[model samples]
Target: MNASELQDIIAWMIDGARSAPTPPQMMAECSERLVRAGLPIWRVGVFVRTLHPEIYGRSFFWTHGGRVETGTVDHKILDSPEFAVSPLAPVFRQGVEVRARFDDPASARFPIVEDLRAEGATDYVAVPLINTDGFVNASTWTTRQPGGFTEEQLSAIRSIAVPLARYIEIVTLRRTASLLLDTYVGNRAGEKILGGQIRRGHADTMDAAIWLSDLRGFTALSDRLPAETVVEILNLYFDCQVSAIRANGGEVLKFMGDGLLAVFPVDDYVGDEAEVCSRVLEAARESRAGVKALQFPNGDDVERFRFGVALHLGRVLYGNIGGGDRLDFTCIGPAVNLAARLEKIASRLGRTVVASERFAGICDGGWSDLGEFPVAGFSRAARVYGLHDEISAAAN
Candidate 1:
């Protein structure tokens, strides 16, 4: 391998890596450059363990003439037998390199080595990408050439490991940030924040079918049940509501204790309000069925769970709001306030789902006008409506 070629790879890692945007692209470029540098390697892989609740890590695999491919491992993969027996275990656990010369009788015995040997690979090496924090990531290089990688080729490969680790850390950190943002905040809000909407007072009015839901009697339940039980029930409750909201194209913006706030935006300026109403209505029905079907156990019996949902159609100020140095990226306006009040009205009327007259009017049918009632905030009596069957059953 030419010394200048190795230098080119290191130069890109130190400077031009940002252009790659993602790890797979970095893997592709680095592997292709390694080949260009005259290393007799046919396969390259970089595995980065990520900080995430569900995902164990990600894999970037590059072949000599093929484009880079990517995949993810679940947390369970760490405990699997395949991972236990693989050379990556030592490389990742102890930050050491493992070499296998398929042509030699004394090489390491691992399932991956035998598989590579089957593919005509004569040499296999697993190297650790040690981060500055001392966390170890793993990578592999395999060669199908008859004589395999020489001492010079292995040395050149080792030279790039540090720089490659730096690039992988940057890329992986950005990804984990994006993932966590999308998890804690809704996807729409996450994108806006990442796109530089962090400043306070930055807001946009959006027309949406607003959704506010609350667990009925949650305060009393929390008073009696254990703290962990309260949390467990709330998670069970929100999981159903949040999943329904997201599945129906709504973004859950806030979890206000026992209540949740979400919105189905009318993205198209000329979009029909009726469509958003329909989607929110469907989500409402799904959420109702979900909680009623929940059978959470106490000690000897299932704990009863009932909830309320209020849907309204209106515009809200959606963005950052807080004092200096602290901000909350959320939605607040007349619409949300009205939704909150209607949720209370649902509880008063012993109903599972109710809507503002505006939301109910836009829907095709199935609404029963609950008549005018003086809500807490507004001066005038607001007209509320309930789904025909939901009102008939009273509360579930």
Candidate 2:
């Protein structure tokens, strides 16, 4: 292909990537670009082996039609080293200018090509896709046609390698983000119900105030609606709740089936007790206020939330805690338990905001006369107060 034609193809691939619905679409578009560039047999994709090595699982993989048929690679190549892997067994052993024309059966470079050749492929070219971190995602390529991929073809392919690498990175990040969220949400629920501590895999321990919230009348509401509708409503509700929690500088740890747990670390502890109290209160009120705006398909209003917000300055263990097969991201301590209990108290007392006296004592306004009461598991009557305003409230 001429310079202008190559440039046009590159531009097309970039534009297609921007609008592609899925990563595989981007790959397919790229393969098409290679074919138009005069390379035959366009098949491309990414592959990752399992971390356990023993599991030898394909943690992730995606492909576009280049040389191999859409799904013909089959089950065998999945776990076996027969297919290309990263760095240690990358297609481009050295730089991007790699060529294997002899179709050397003994050549270590294109091990998988031999398998494909045995299955009918005679010649092909594979270019390694490497991240900035030097992690090899996979190779992009063209299958055997006439004279195989030339040095000029490798150069042309190199020009667009970074963009293709970015595409792989996007897929990797999305998968990672999804897995992290699942583990985070799962662990939070586990801790809430199991009564133990679980720390996040990322951070060591965060010194922050935790918040627990539950929906009012969710049980009755679920009973009234079909199971699908119930799930839809709950998902919508949590979407808003999770959004609010993150918006207010807190991480949503878990959703307790009908409730949620969040925290504002004292590490980022922006203000004093009053400041923390105000922020936490504002987040709670916003969460509650947002619920009223949600509507279901049946036209019924969404359920409201009654938050039992307890902001205590204390140490809490935060991490994964579960069987070896499963891990959970959550916080555990007397403080988290106390916060949950406070939420229940708030519901019963008909108070919109209920907090421990320990938190109240350090802050400033918006408190009312709920007085002191003996908490269920605690030996003493913990001092508790109801919040009238989101901010400008004292804890004592």
Candidate 3:
């Protein structure tokens, strides 16, 4: 390829990188452009490490046939033999490039080289992309040319490596931030924060079906069981509740020790009060059943697990709240307070699930009135209701 042609291709890549194109798009564009510039490129792969809890890194692949594919490498893969022996591994660890001539069978030290040779590839080049932070990523190219990549082709690949690394670093950082926010905070809250709601006093009021739940005898269990066992049981218990709530379209707001707070926004359902209330009730029922089915891994505890759930519908302040520089994105209001109070009442009344009068008024399912009770932090006593006998029995 001529210098002018290579310059044009590099310009195109810089434009794409500046515009924040996704990794896959960037890989495909660069590969296609190189092939069009008289390089015998058949496949291109770009891999970068990312900051994520569940994922170790990401890989983007582009083929000669215009197909793009992506794969996520788990943290466990770093210990695997395949990664240890791969060309990119040395590029990252040794801070050097790896060039293999697949046409020479004796040069095929890695298993991947043999596979590439079988696919009619003659040359493979893996370049180390060093970031400003001294981290090394890798971008590899494969060619089907009988003799291998020409000098000009290799030079072109080398020239684009730095800028490509810069682009991918930006993209990966953005993705890492997003994943961390979503993982630590609820999705709705994360979006709000990402959308410039960082001010400590920022808040929005919305109507929602509030849910509160806590495991029965959790305090006693923690005291009796080993600390590790208590943690295991807590995780298992929360898994049941969280899965059920999320499956029923509820966003878990916060986990407070043995208890949790969640909500199903009525506004999200177009103010469908009945539907929102029913979802919260259904989630509660499912959570109860799930807890009943859980069998502790160890035989040390044979007692059945139990919990109390309460549902209420009301308007809540949904946003940041706390002292300056330290805030929590969660719901707060009388509705949230009432849900917690009713959860305690559920335990006292020997009922697994309880619903506020406001929630029951909109729900279509049968509920048995549990009568009025004096609630803390409120002027008047609040009326609570429990699920019908048949439904409660079936849940048990």
Candidate 4:
């Protein structure tokens, strides 16, 4: 609190708050300095509370030092009023610093003291780190001691808050930039899809409905067009298909060029084959409409889409499937196989949509009989139906 000490503290804050190449590293440095400066505690956790970027809107665990119990800690702090909308939230939102000690019972406006008493927090201090944009990127802290932190200690921590904020801003920008470049490029797109995979046999027993559809003759179209044109056309086609699938409460698990694999779980979000079938059918209809509207580069018309759809409901494990080096998030079961087979049958039968007896029975009787057909990889002839009149009527 002396003049020279104050000058030194101001200088440190200025350096910390100045723009840096790496915000994450700055955070680490701040923690180490605070711990080394005779703070009662050595470990710290940084919690980011913000609504910017939309993706990070949820209040959850951000980061922590080696010794802090971060992810394992409960999330009740987000609603405790003391931490959530308190001086901490406002200060951080305005890019200001807030330093507080939890040991003081007199500081009733803050609940960390009571929280510690309830959850066995013996001692703690916190400083909200706000970036220039006014969003609180991280809350720095020290905790777990015999006595509570004092005002002098809190002020010392507060003095470093601005730089911590600046550090967080830089780190977030770097991470975001890297992801943007990675996802927006060609080869990197393939890599990320492969990265989020699980073992081949992992997803096998959840209540799920497999929906598979593919545009017929897409290979021939690709062959006829330039590579760049093919890429443009495919992007346009998928934008529609993916949007429709998502809107109908389905997850587009994988896109196999012209084919798409999606799933609807009755237990999870939307249930029942009839409802799921109706949704899948709606999505397919929209996709067909979307594709038919797409124009070719030559100013001549491209061919309309002819797609085959198959739906099956059963218990299936759903996750990323692959071996050691690669993975793809998709569903697996006899249901998925059967659905794919039905799609092939639809193609051969010259129909736009086909469903199994299980799916047909569950659908609105708009489905008339197409009779049984012997299909590959099945012991019995699978009864299938062409879903045309019912769906066409529904669309009208």
Which numbered prediction scores highest in TM-score against the true structure?
1
RMSD in order of candidates: 2.3, 14.3, 2.8, 13.8
lDDT tens string, model 4, 93-177? 5655554455555556665456545654555544566667655655645456556566676666666656555655665665555
Query: After aligning candidate 2 to the native by TM-score, how far in Å is the CA of 306 from where it should be?
Result: 5.6
What is the per-residue lDDT of model 2 for residues 175-271, given as tens digits with 9 covering 90 to 100?
5544544455643344343443333353245566678777766887777789888888788878766777666667777777888878876644366
lDDT of 1: 0.87
TM-score of 3: 0.90
Candidates ranked by lDDT: 1, 3, 4, 2
Which candidate do you rate higher for TM-score, 1 or 2? 1
Candidate 4: clashing pairs of residues = 16-163, 17-163, 23-167, 198-320, 203-317, 204-317, 205-317, 206-316, 266-271
Q: Model 1: which ten-residue window has the lowest total lDDT? A: 387-396
Better of 1 and 2 by lDDT: 1
- Candidate 1's residue-wise lDDT over 79-191, tens digit each? 99998988899998889999988877767568787788878899998999988889999999999988888898899889988898888777777788788888877888999
Q: Candidate 2: lDDT of 302? A: 42
The local lDDT score (0 to 100) that residue 272 gets in candidate 3 is: 89
Model 1 regions more than 4 Å off: 18-21, 103-109, 392-396
